[model samples]
Target: MRQLLSYGLFGVIFFHLFFPHNISAQSVDTVYFSLDMTEPISEGWLKHGTEIVGIRGDQSPLNWGNTFEASDPDKDGIYEVAVPFNLHSDSLLVSFKIKVDGVNNPDDGWQKGRNHEAMIYQGVKNKVTLKWADEPPQAPTTITGQVEIFRDFQSDNLVPRDLYVYLPPGYKESNQRYPVLYMHDGQALFDASEIGQEWRVDEAAEELIRAGEIEPVIIVGIGNTQNRFDEYTPTEQVWRYELNRISSQERTTFPEAFAGNYISTEGDTIRFKTKHDTLLTMIPGGQFWQPLIPESEHAFFLAQAGITFTFDVKETEVNQVVASKPTMGGDGDLYGGFIIKKVKPFIDQNFRTRPEREFTSLGGSSLGGLITLYLGLEYQDTFSNLLVVSPSVWWDGQMIISKVNELPGATNQHIWLDMGTAEGEGAVESAKALNKALLNKGWSKENLNFVIEEGAAHNERAWAKRVPDMLRFLYSKN
Candidate 1:
């Protein structure tokens, strides 16, 4: 293990390596990361001590980033540590994993697909707001519902996928068959650690049910696997295109790569010549520029560039492509088919559900939304109602809309298409165009509801607020 020696008034850093060769460590300000485990530890929740392991940035001699033991100085279970190393660059974005005892240890409780992240500049100090190992927010006491996870649900045709079933109140007591809403991103819909915000669908359903605004329905949230992006995309073609485009760094520079021409760079800030009508000083650096870069390599990118890029693009951009990987794309339609054939049957057999297409529904947000729309269109007989929230119609060069237009059908399907006003210009406009496409497909206003939410953004919290409205529209018998 390598140790980082901090420098003070003398401004000298010493590195103590395992081999006993003393080398001067670079001078950098100490960054403190504090984790309040008082609630979890004192309450007999976490028994194991936690260690913070830096997942990204300059782990060269440190054996895959630095691992520092958190000290509870006050013995209040509030562990605090001033990281041995300082921020070398302004662009340094660090991700830390709080292993309970250590990685691969049973006592080391950790959440899958959740990690503490920070954009650390020089002398920046941050705290882990959430509990050790991204714990799910406690279920609201006001809600009369519970989320049950179907661990490693097996499928003959496809890989294993977990299912989260949210049963409404009095479901077990009553022998009534309820409509089922199949949603993507099961892990995130209820848990905050998976994504920064949860959709709170369970809470929303309970509220709506109690208020009699919407009928009691069973929500089957299909937790995405490691191959989420590929599974969520409709066709292999779209998957291939996205995989190639995102992985291939053919165009990342200014003037030719990101659709914006390079104008000037004052310091590290490059002024790109904007030809687009929309006025913006900065956009989310990831959305436009990081389409090609994987997040795991962000530390490496930051190390190369002294300063990190900033844009007007908000936190919504982070949730958009979290599941994207550098692996080659495969057939997502097959994966979707597995859900329809294998998973749906298992759901129907286990729970009392309306198996008919009219009573069955599919929904998701972002890429999940895109796949839901595609599945709804392709398998119209399978799903009659769809909750499409901010579908990525821009995928495959906007091929989905064209495909929908080519398909001749006056199918009677209940569709709720919506986008937030605060969502990026492309997302908002694409959703509107999709609404038009649905209209052209013979969908009447009575069947389709197009909504542009006022001041709503693209995060899960934004989606949760609109859930009741979409549910009312889709399931209302009146």
Candidate 2:
């Protein structure tokens, strides 16, 4: 006998009935996925060769770790797959992406952008059409007003990069000067971006200006280069500490005064003798060690155990350690100099801009955000507003917070600082600590706007959502 179990609108299950024996159940709810291979196939980006099309998602039988193959039964350009999901409730929300020739690797053929999400109702067969990452749907031209792109703008302090200048509406008609907000990562600020998603800054700015929600302003987007890490970071990052220690069995006693021995390297191994008389050896595998700060030649950082060591290498052994240390950062000052001396002059001369400090602002996110804070503090007289979004406060051990604490008094700049709860606890906590530091440094509540957006992730999508708020706070008519 066949028995049916109905869960109202939630779902339906079928069970094979046996005489007081075991039974098997099956779910009726299924999701159908279809993929269009015309574009990728025609463009030569994908060949309809033996490569299998599949779907990968967060649901059971559809995890990101592996792909569930789809079939082109009729040899048509369209490939389809029916996925059955066991439903416990009325509905299920699934997030997924399309993959081609994907085995156990998540990124083998994964599509970009934010993951596609769908709400699946029990007892319902939902159909979805997806395109490949090679052929992402073109985003509509959401840019409003005028944008001027300067390709390979030369800089004396840093490498040349493109610059995107966004002019507000009526700027061409009127002769009034507008305040300028300089942002980093120019490529990700517009509709077309190197990253899959864009921040849509132009759209947000245009909408807010039209609604009179914020004062009309000009925005400058500074393009980044391959040296983004060096240009954005204020100090060199310690990849990891290398310690060469003799085993307890191989211990050789030494005087307590000799505990402060200098680090010396022989060939590939770094040798140092500790007070315990144990020969410490560190095999140079990663980047060489450098002082975290500019003023110090040798810096002290904790490694395994409670032992402390000063990283001081002689000038002759610098080349030996060079092989051990990764490329050191601390080029942020030069980056700031480039913006101030090159980009700012060009903008001020070419455009009708309010060049005063009160009308100037800087904004960025992640490492870009970190550099923005560094620039805002370093050039307090040059910028009056700052939009620091999801800054990497963990950079160089929260050096930004210490920079704020060292400030004698807070300047009159308006600052917008924010972090998403989903960005991770370390990031959220770092933002909170920076907030408290700013508050203690005499920044008033009206001047510093700190927001912790719940359920927000650290990506362009989240930043795009907060752009309007950032503009409102930084350029409010009030």
Off by over 4 Å in 1: 1-144, 193-196, 237-330
lDDT of 2 by residue, 111-166 (tens): 76656767899867688888764344445555556888899999876888999899
How well does each candidate superpose onto the true structure, as a TM-score? 0.57, 0.60
On TM-score, the candidate that comes out on top is 2
TM-score of 1: 0.57
* Clash counts for all predictions: 5, 12
Show the lowest summed lDDT stretch of 10 residues, model 1: 9-18
- Candidate 2's TM-score reads 0.60
* Model 1, residue pairs in steric clash: 282-312, 283-311, 283-312, 283-313, 284-313
Count residue pairs with overlapping backbones in model 2: 12
